[model samples]
Target: MTTQATLTPAKELAAKNRARFPNESAEYRQARNALLAEEIELRRHIERVAERRRQLPPGGEVTKDYRFEGENGPVALADLFGDKDTLIIYSYMFGPEREKPCPMCTSLMASWEGKVPDIEQRVALAMVARSPIERLVAAKKARGWRQLKVYSDSDGSFTRDYVSADDADVPAYTVFTRRDGTIRHFWSAEMSSEMADPGQDPRDAPDPDPLWTLLDTTPEGRGANWYPKLEYPSAG
Candidate 1:
């Protein structure tokens, strides 16, 4: 454990940064250095939050054997873990009533599709929905996702219990851990629209979506009105 007093100050480290661009102005450099210091502090804060999450006391034990329909056949919550002890389930907003899935959810899933294999190296990952498995599989095929595993919470039991009691079509990210024959609820991204700042949208800290992260680095940032779409006019 590195002590705070012994660690180099973020501002000092930022000052030592030698990165320079061609024809950069002094005012820009000064402002950028200050921003860099803040970024460094933000990184440290993120790590601290992660460590605190890791130290959290054991979560509630999962008693119900939630069932889901996978691409091939039926599977239980425990079976989702596969060979890993930790399982991450992303419940996207794809229910029976909607003709198309939620654009935001689809965007996030698209970003995660390619990284599924890399992510599974440490924990099992599954994309789940309340629609039928066939519909979910069709969506997966349409998206051209090769590695991401899709499943259907056919009965909406899992969604009602963990995601929303009203069973509203919403996206949720939940993690469960299996150890010593016991599966327990783990950390979840609980931040919602209600918790967001006045101008910002609901999002988790150290956001899992790379799109937003990338946009945040730009001058426009993530615009208030703009959002992802299932099909773009320019995509063709």
Candidate 2:
């Protein structure tokens, strides 16, 4: 792969002298164009990665009887699948002490809740956590996440097996498939980085976190790297 120099000195100077500071020059134009090209290529790479992830093999039979609850009442892991061929579970980070949802996880979950109908059409979705089921449920209610299928993984091992344990841990989005009364593992995405860019292969960063994106628009600039307390303005 050819590495494009998107951070030439010229680009730096131009960025420092943008519309907010307005000092147009030929060098700046060249640098800007180069940066734009690089960005376009990066986006294309991200699209390819998404496609590749979609094609990954669903391994392991996971028909184990894991039980939990939802708005619809008592549910098993299999029930979450909703007769679909695939099951997608998300390991949320809302712990017992969370007076509010983790900003990043909340952002992702809130978005998922919005996309639930569409996401459900393609894959069964659920947010799992080790917190007590009631605690998790209350947090979800407070967040107004009515559509999301929130569940408790209080046993802890379920999360350990999937590799999402602790606050700093990355939320894991795992996919599974059911066949012959058994479930198989499929695709999984782990967010190890604190600040992720949604751009392409983020082996170095988490995807541009939607929460950060939303918060960044405000003058706070994501507020000294601190997140929004689930209780909101009152939490501080």
Candidate 3:
């Protein structure tokens, strides 16, 4: 039978203390250096994977010319591309059932908001939802997001078309390119559990989520695998 962990008062007290490792022996030092080299090599491999993304062939056909509300009003699908050579459409999963914006999505977009100027210089980035324009705008305001250009697909067809919001497909980060009045898909990323690790770091920047930074303080140490969850409604 599986046993559930029970924390006695003493156990809980012990958990509050930081873990300390013993001094290493000469053999341990040699093994540690070799392991450090392996870690560096693994990071280099991840960098190479990121590099391959830039080399992907650009040509994902837009199956439908979906309309979306722009700052002025209704705008053609192509207008969303702005003036950039590449367009990144993030399919956000905030729907009627969600009740509130997703904290995980919020965390990712928070980083995007700060990079808008730099991103717009080379690529068009937009957050897409299947909700009404007003609803999407309201949620954006609630989240204090100013940098992301929001769009509403109301009909789930856009989500289905891009494989971005299906239960089977997790939130996707996809890049597309336009040529001769045609849009083509370039790259898509959806990391699987096998690819994730205890030390996995997704963001390339030094600045990380303050939420995670704070959570790293406790004994759980971010609890093996974790993602941000909405707190106002006390995450289901």
Candidate 4:
């Protein structure tokens, strides 16, 4: 770990950046350099938060043998770990009562679908819903997602315990760690939409969604009214 005393100041590092655009004004350069310094500090802050998360004490042991319905057949929570010691389960808002899934959850899942294989190399990943196994599989096929491993918490046992007590159609991200054949809850994204700031939407630090992250770089930023949808009209 690098101490703050030994690390160079973000502003000093930004001063060394000589990047220039054609015919750009001096004011633009000065502002950009200032923003660059802030960005550097943001990166350092992210690392510090990650380190703190990794140092968290061991969580509660998962006593119940929760089961889920996978594409192939029934599977237990322990089985989802495969050969990895860590497992990440994303509870998407696709309850049996709803005809379609939540657009926000869909957008997040779509972004992760392509990276599933790469992610599985380090830790097991599962996309779970409160709908039946058949319904979940159908949705996966409709979306043309080949890599994401969809599952169904058919009985809602896992959903009620880890996601929502009322079994509401909400998205959740939970992580579990397996050590010595015992499964334990490691961490979860507990921040809910109700926790959002006055102007900003509820979101976690180092958000997992690439869509919002990409939008953040634009001048317009992630607008208050704009949101992702299940489908968009074809472009001419």
Q: Which candidate is the best by lDDT?
A: 4
Q: Across residues 181-202, which tens digit of lDDT does each residue of candidate 2 receive?
A: 7777876665555455554223
In candidate 1 the C-alpha lDDT for residue 20 amounts to 100
| Per-model lDDT | 0.92, 0.67, 0.68, 0.94
Tens digit per residue, CA lDDT, model 1, 1-236: 33354667899999999999999999999999999999999988887888788888889999998999999899999999999999999999989999988999999999998888899999999999999999998988999988989999999899999999999998899999999989999888899889999988889888898999999999999999999999877865
Per the 3 Å backbone cut-off, how many clashing residue pairs does candidate 3 have?
A: 4
Stretches off by above 4 angstroms in model 1 are 1-5, 234-236
Question: How does candidate 2 fare on TM-score?
Answer: 0.68
lDDT of 2 at 134: 83
Q: Select the stronger candidate by TM-score from 1 and 3.
A: 1
Which number leads on TM-score?
A: 4
| lDDT assessment of candidate 4 | 0.94
| Per-model root-mean-square deviation over C-alphas | 1.4, 7.1, 12.4, 1.2
- Global CA lDDT of candidate 2, please? 0.67
Rank candidates, TM-score, best first: 4, 1, 2, 3
For model 1 the TM-score comes to: 0.96
TM-score comparison, 1 vs 2, better candidate: 1
Task: Give all TM-scores, in the order shown.
Answer: 0.96, 0.68, 0.68, 0.97
